[model samples]
Target: MPRTDKASRLIAAPPARVYAAFVDPDELLAWLPPGDMTGRFDHFDARTGGSYRLTLTYPDAGTGKTTTDSDVVEARFVEVVPGVRVVQAVDFVSDDPAYAGTMIMTWAVAAAESGTRVEIRADNVPDGISAEDHAVGLASSLANLAAHVEN
Candidate 1:
């Protein structure tokens, strides 16, 4: 069954600033998680047809012992409307049984009375990926973004 995860937050920043948060790799690296996991951009072009790859390490959660590994992932920008919306399709590139295929993710920014309302929707997840996992990830990413922009 196809799965979808949706999450939203009211950010005090403007839409443009929030939108730029996704385009810049350095900014993304500052906020995107698995908190301890770090990533390097093989590509960072932010346009339709543009692609990106990143290495993600899953370290021991308790010991903080680091593991060096990478996922040969790829993503294509599906849509981008400055200060309004961004969408992409991304997938894992590994033979490991834990890693699967592609998924569609959409981020929208809408102006509100107080600030911009940011919503992230991940849709069409492959089987075995749960909506709860996506929801937690989205919540964490947004919280990280808020922290980055606020501080």
Candidate 2:
């Protein structure tokens, strides 16, 4: 069976602002990367069936892990609903056979009492990615988002 990762957080921002953080390339760069990583998008189109390429780079070496300079992702939007949801088809650019297939990442945004409830679900995860690491990465990204939007 394929592996999946799910993470959720209550962001201290409205649904529209939280949703905008995902689709806006500039906002994405501010919050998408986890921990000591940074992100840059080649180009972004915020519509159904639109595609984008992003590069994530790690700048620090203290994590005790030998890592690549960058990880690239080529993704397309499968579904897009303003302030509500986004479903993406993502493929990592890697030579490893285990990471060759396409995975689905869904972002569900809902209106909560004071802010927005954001949930992320990643399905068909590549075997090359460690589940524990991915969980940390997901949680980290959410925390980054909260920090970006709440301040």
Candidate 3:
């Protein structure tokens, strides 16, 4: 069976700013990686039908899906609504069958009383990623995002 993971945060920024952080490569590079991972994009295009390839390098050895310390992800922009939402179809570039599948990642931002409410929903998550780990990763990413946009 497929699994879904979700995380949300209230950022002290406007919706447009929060949304831009999601689409901009520089902003994404600053906050997308969770925990001790660092990220760089091989190519990026933020639009419907566009695509991007991102490589995330983990701090620890032998903890990556693609390489010994790296995880490569190829994602296509399935939907892009400015200031509202962005939906991506993501694939992990790995030889292991446990991580070979397309996952849908939906990022939604909405105006709130204090700030923008950002939510991320990941569907059809690969079985190789445990739920607890994914939850921590998602929360970490959200916290990073909040820090990036709030400051």
Q: Which of the numbered candidates is closest to the native, going by highest lDDT?
A: 3
Per-prediction TM-score: 0.85, 0.93, 0.98
Q: Which portions of model 2 show Cα errors greater than 4 Å?
A: 60-67
Model 1 lDDT-worst window of ten: 59-68
| Candidate 3 structure lDDT | 0.96
Q: lDDT tens string, model 3, 1-151?
A: 6899999998999999999999999999999999989999999999999999999999898999999999999999999999899999999999999998999999999999999999999999999999999999999999999999996
lDDT of 2 at 5: 95
How many angstroms is residue 36 displaced in model 1 relative to the true structure, after the best TM-score fit?
3.0
Local distance difference test, each candidate: 0.74, 0.88, 0.96
Better of 1 and 2 by lDDT: 2
Candidate 2 at residue 100, lDDT?
74
* Per-residue lDDT of model 1, residues 9-47, tens digit only: 998887788888888889888877645566678778888
For candidate 3, which ten residues in a row score worst on lDDT? 1-10
lDDT of 2 by residue, 55-149 (tens): 88888543322246778899999999887999999998887777778899999899999899999999999887889999999999999999999
Clashes of each: 0, 0, 0
Model 3: what TM-score?
A: 0.98
